[model samples]
Target chain A: MSITISNISKSYKNVKALQDISFEVKENELFGLIGPDGAGKTTLFRILTTLLIANEGTATVAGFDVISDYKMIRNSVGYMPGKFSLYQDLTVEENLNFFATIFGTTIEENYDLIKDIYVQIEPFKDRRAGKLSGGMKQKLALCCALIHKPKVLFLDEPTTGVDPVSRKEFWDMLKRLQQKGITILVSTPYMDEAALCDRIALIQAGKILEIDTPKAIVKHYSKPIYNVRANNMYQLINSLNDYEYNHSVYPFGEFVHYTDKRADFNQKELKMYLETKNLTDIEIEKTIATIEDTFMELAK
Target chain B: MKIILYIIQKEFKQIFRNKGMLPIIFVLPLLQLVILSNAATFEVKNIKFGYIDNDHTSTSRTLVEKFNASTYFDVLTDFPSEGLASSSMLNGEVDVVLEIPQYFERDLQKEKYNSLGITINAIDGAAAGVENVYVTQIVQNFNQNLKVDLLQVSDKQIQPITIETIPLFWYNETLNYKTFMVPGILVLLVTMITLFLSGMNIVREKEIGTLEQINVTPIKKSQFIIGKLFPFWVIGIGLLTIGLIIAKLIFDVPMVGSLVLMYFYTSIYILVILGIGLFISNFTDTQQQAMFIAWFFTVIFILMSGLFTPIESMPEWAQILTEFNPIKYFVEVMRMVMLKGSSFIDVLPQIIKTFLFAFIMNGLAVWSYKKTT
Candidate 1:
């Protein structure tokens, strides 16, 4: 195992941020923790990176204890914080060189690792880091973290505010980094990014809802889902709930995705029942479950 | 160590690139050294005086000539009466006035005793007192001269008593206020620049979200701090060097001490300032708050550092309070090295105090910096 966490718990003054959370990432696995804001993702990443100490239990990165062997863990792992955290006044080249020097290495020693990404922004290396575009800064921060060729990489919501195109490019770069035999643990709020990871943990309110591959998690969501749209969508949903057949009804964009509570509920009866309410343009079709669907089901 | 060099290089680049602040850090200190130095002197000149010559005789005229010949006073106007002379003194036009009574020479010849009226402005009491001494000395000299010329034709002898006082000023021969103020002002400039720059550096990173990125890195806390402070330390020394050069070229201030010794003390002094800047950086979260707090303490330090006023003249409590001020030691060492050409042994106490302050401040800064979980 590249990372091992057991019974880890942390809390603020009156709020528990993480409760008995335990998980492991295998060597060279692209693992992800998927959650919305305030789901304890940053807290957990901090503990795993040895920047924070766990109040209970133990975590080991690369076979070294996080607290007792923090130096070893730091030397072996790389972390990119959720926010852009690099020296702004320094030039891009200077920032990279400084971080490399701190880790007892040089740009020439690890040039092969970051060359693919650094080259794209190499022309503007002399520009101050503060003046660079967000995407360019993101790339520079990544290069600094990877300059030492660590065994595991921890990135906490690295693409939260990035543009969609930059977000896609960032994930593509992560894929290439994974090819270099480095274990990567990334966290994100976007459900779509869940499928790109080897395995993912769905978290809510500081608790894990599920931990499995995206496809497996979706397959395990045993429910009949339907996308229902009508001229009067609100009335349809409210009336459907009263019919005692609705499991859950939530608006998904312009249409409502509803699941049946009873395994034997008939769709034809539901359609007829909606028509009796004088609802026009009614369309009800069974749809495949997605990671978001599984997450909502598990959360509920 | 190599990381520290990288950090130092980065700091130099930032300071040089900041166009708005470059002149403020480099040029303002030199300008202050030149302008404020001229205004700080204790030597008094161009003292205006008015007189009412009631006797209007050659004796009174000779006394007036004596006053005019002296460098301390200038006869601004001759008042027709004592009322006019006293009114001019009240209106602040004249600092002193002389009233020669009627028959002053006749009484001096007959009774060998006469008193002339002398009134003086008492505000700024010290300067007024010094001027009074100068007036008395000139009058006594005139009395002796009169007795000598009278004795040439009479069968009598006149004996005059005189007191001679020799003043020996140590450390500064000419007592040029510029030589004293330049080193002290340089200390203030070094402290202000380093404290503000280093205090703002980390807070800027925090504001822009880059501090989080550094936290995630595998670097140790000590390494990060050393990297951050090393650069500002270099910049602090660079500012000192520029300030010294300007002080020499423009003000013609003598650097009597060894250049190597100045550099050595300056390096240690900048370390103290860098440590202070780092300590301030750890306490503040925003650049504005950091600047305000830095500015607040800087005002207090400059006022209490004995730069503008003598600490010995302050109240006993205030004098005791200055022992904790780091600027006090810096100013003391700079003055000792530059003006007195003091050897390392001569400034050992100040050096030790500053070194201790540097150690404690930097230690506190590192301890306060937390890698947030």
Candidate 2:
């Protein structure tokens, strides 16, 4: 394991941020910490990166204990905070040179690692970092984080507040870095990103509900699920929810993801029931489980 | 050590590139040194004088003439009654009220213990104090003239035990206010620039989210702080040089002391101020908070540093408080060295105190700063 977290907990005054959270990420694996905001994703990343200490338990990154060997861990890990943290006043090139120099390295020393990203931003090297567009800023932050050539990378909500194309391109960079044998511990709120991770830890309210591959997580759904669409999605949900055998119901895009409590559920009966309620053009069919469905199920 | 040098280089680059900081660091201090020195003074001039002559004798008129003859009092009006005199004072027509009693100079000639009723506006307490002293000196001169009139047939000297006092003010023969104030204001400008810049610069990084980026790196805490202070230290020295040149060129302030020794003392003093600033930056979460706290302490230090008033004149407790103030020591050193042509030995004690102050302050700063929470 490249990252080992065993029973780590943290709290602020009256609110518990993380509680007994345990997980591991393998070497060269793209491990995604999937959660909504305030689910302790950033907190766990902070503890593992040795920027914070856990109150209860121990964590090790790159075979070094987080608290005891924090210096070594800090030397080896590259952390991009949730916020865009490069010096806004410094130009793109100056910002890069400053970080590299402070880390006891030079741009020429780590030219191979940042070449691709730097080239894209090289045209605007003279421009201040604050004036860069969002996509450009994201790329620059990544380049600076990678310039140190760290053994492990901890990215907190790297893709949050990012455009779709840029998000995809950023993950692609992470994939390339992973190919170079660097362990990646990344957190994101988007459920779709879960499918891209080698293994995922589903988190909520400071607890890890489940830890498994995305396919396995979705496969763990015990009940047969359904996707139903109608002329009006709003009334369709209220009408289906009024059914006596309905176990759970929630809207997922154009379809209402649903399950039944009945031992022998009948789609024809559910359709007839919706028709009686005047949910016309109602369509109901069995569908495979998605990560969102699994997340909502476990979160319940 | 190499890492610290890099941090310093980066800090200098940022300070120069910041258009807002450049004028404030360079122009503002010099402007204040030139202009503010004129505004700050203790010499009371042009007092608005109103008096009630209840005794319309030669004694009261002669006394009024004495005041009018002196340039300090303007002698705005003569009132017929106490009510009118006090009313003019209430209307802000005058700062001082002199009321002669109805004795027609009989009390002084017979009893030789008559008291004049002198009322002064006490607002801006320091100005009021100086005004009171000037009025007392004028009254003493009047009494001396009376004595001299009596002794004309005998001798000019009022000889009980004649110990003639030859009052001479050294280093400031004329007691020019600017000669004293320019050196003190220079200290304030240097303290203001270094303290505010170091405090705000680090706190700005915190505000911009860059501090967290620096914190997560392998940089040592001391290295980061030393790097941050290096540029402002140079700026402080540069400010001192500019202020000194302005003082010499415009105000013709005497620089009898060695410039090299002054720079050496100021270099250490700037460290103390910057250390305090960085310590404040380390604990505060926002630049606004740091600015407020820095402002609070700087105001207190300036007030207690005897920048506008004498430290010896303050209460004993307040004087003790000034001992802990680094600005106090720097202000004293600047005045002592600049005006008195004080040699290195003259300022050695202040230099040692400032060095200890720098050591303690920077030690606290480095100890309080942490990379981890």
Candidate 3:
């Protein structure tokens, strides 16, 4: 395993940020800690990176214990903090050179690794980091983190504030970095980004809900899901929940994806129930569960 | 060490690239050194005076002429009444008013006794004291003249007393206030700029979510800190060099001490400031908060550092409190080196104190910077 975390628990004053959290990322794998805000994603990342000591449990990155071998661990990892952490006053080229130098390396030595991304905005190398557009800054920060040629890259919500196109571009860059045989641990609140990961840990409220491949996790969802639509969608939802056969009913997009308590119940019964409530033009069909659906089910 | 140099290079780039703060950090200190140094002299000149001569006698007239003849006092008005002269003094229109009493010459001739009323505005006590001394000296000279004229015997003798202060002002012989003020103000500028920049740099990263990216990386805390502080240190030194050059050319402030010694002390001083800034940055989550806290401490340091006031004159407890202030030592060392031509041996104590402070503060800063898991 490239990374190992066992029974890692942490608390902040009165709030429990993580509880008995354990996970592992294999070498060169793109692992993700998926959760909403305040789900202890950041806490776990900090511990693995040796920035924070776990309250209870042990975590090791690349065969070195986070506590005892922190210096060695730090030397090998590339961390892009959740925030834009580069010096804003320094120009793009200067920031990159600084990070490279800190790692006891030079831009020319690692130019092949970052040249692809760095070249895109190389024209503005002299421009102050603070003045760059949001997308450009994101690319520059990534370049700086990668310039050190770290073995393990830990990115905490690298796409939180970026535009859609830039977000896509950033993820693509991460994939290329992963291709270089670097262990990648990335966390994000965006569920859509979760599917891009090779394996994901669904976390909520500082607890790991589940950990599995995206397809496998969705495949394991056991509920009889249905996407229900009707002319009066609101009334149809109320009528469906009020129905005696209802298990769970929640709005998902333009239609409501629901499940029934009776596994063998058909759509005719649901339609009859909706019609009895004076709801018309109702349509109901079975649908495949998504990661969000799995998350909602697990959260419940 | 390599990481530290990288950080230093980055810091220099940032300081120079920042258009808004470049002028403030570099130019403003030099401008103040020039303007305020000229304005801050203790030598008094151009005193305005008014007089009420009730005696209307030759001796009183002659004394009035003597006052006019001296360049120190510009005799603006000759009032007929004491009421008018006193009102002018109360209104601050005149700094000093000489009131001559009735039959001043006759009394001097018969009884060898006379009195003169001298009213002075005493708001600025130091200047007022000096003016009083000058007035007393002139009166004594006038009395001697009277004695000389009345008792023409060559054998006549008079007692004389003189007080002299052989002021051996070490460091700055001429006592140019700029020589003192430039180095002191430079300390403030360096401290303020570095503290604010370093304090704000980390917080800004935290706000923008990039700190997390670095955190996940295998980079060590020491590496990160060295990377961050190195740049700010370079910028601080660069600003000091510019300030020194300006002080030399525009103000003619002497660089009496060894340049190498100055650089050595300044390097340690920058570390102390950068450490303080990083420590503050680690605690604050926002740039605004970091800036406010940095500004607060800097204001206190500059005010209590004895840049504008004598540390010796402050109450004993206040003077004791200043011992803990790092800026005080930096300012002291800079002035000692620049003005007094002090060698490294003379400034060894301050240098050692700064080195210890830099170590403690930087250690605390790195200790405090943790990944908030």
lDDT of 2 by residue, A1-300 (tens): 899999999998889999999988898899999999999998898888877888999999999999989889888999999899999889999999888987888999989888878899999999999999998998899889988999999889988889999999888888888888889989999999889999999999999999999999999998999999999888888887788888889999889999999879999998888888887887888999999999998998
lDDT ranking from best to worst? 2, 1, 3
Best by lDDT: 2
Per model, kept true contacts as a fraction are 0.70, 0.83, 0.67
Q: What TM-score, to 2 decimals, does candidate 1 have?
A: 0.82
The CAPRI category of model 2 is medium
Q: Candidate 2's residue-wise lDDT over B124-185, tens digit each?
A: 78779988998898888887776555454565354556366889999999889999999999
What interface Cα RMSD is found for model 3? 3.5
Q: Stretches of candidate 1 above 4 Å error?
A: A230-247, A260-282, B40-160, B202-212, B215-224, B363-373
The top-ranked prediction according to TM-score is: 2
Local error of candidate 2 at residue B214 (angstroms): 1.7
**Chain B superposition TM-score per model:** 0.85, 0.88, 0.85
Residue B123, candidate 2: C-alpha displacement in angstroms: 4.0
Clash pairs, model 1 backbone: A85-B210, A85-B213, A86-B210
TM of each candidate vs. truth: 0.82, 0.92, 0.82
| Candidate 3 wrongly placed segments (more than 4 Å) | A89-95, A106-140, A147-151, A162-180, A230-246, A262-281, B1-3, B78-91, B149-307, B321-373
lDDT of 1 by residue, A1-300 (tens): 999989999988788999888888999999999998999999999899877787898999999999998878888888888778787778899899888887889999999999999998899999988899999989998998899999999998989889999999999999999999999999999999999999999987788888898899999888988898999978987877777768888778788888988888787898899998888888899988889888888888
RMSD of each: 4.8, 2.9, 4.5
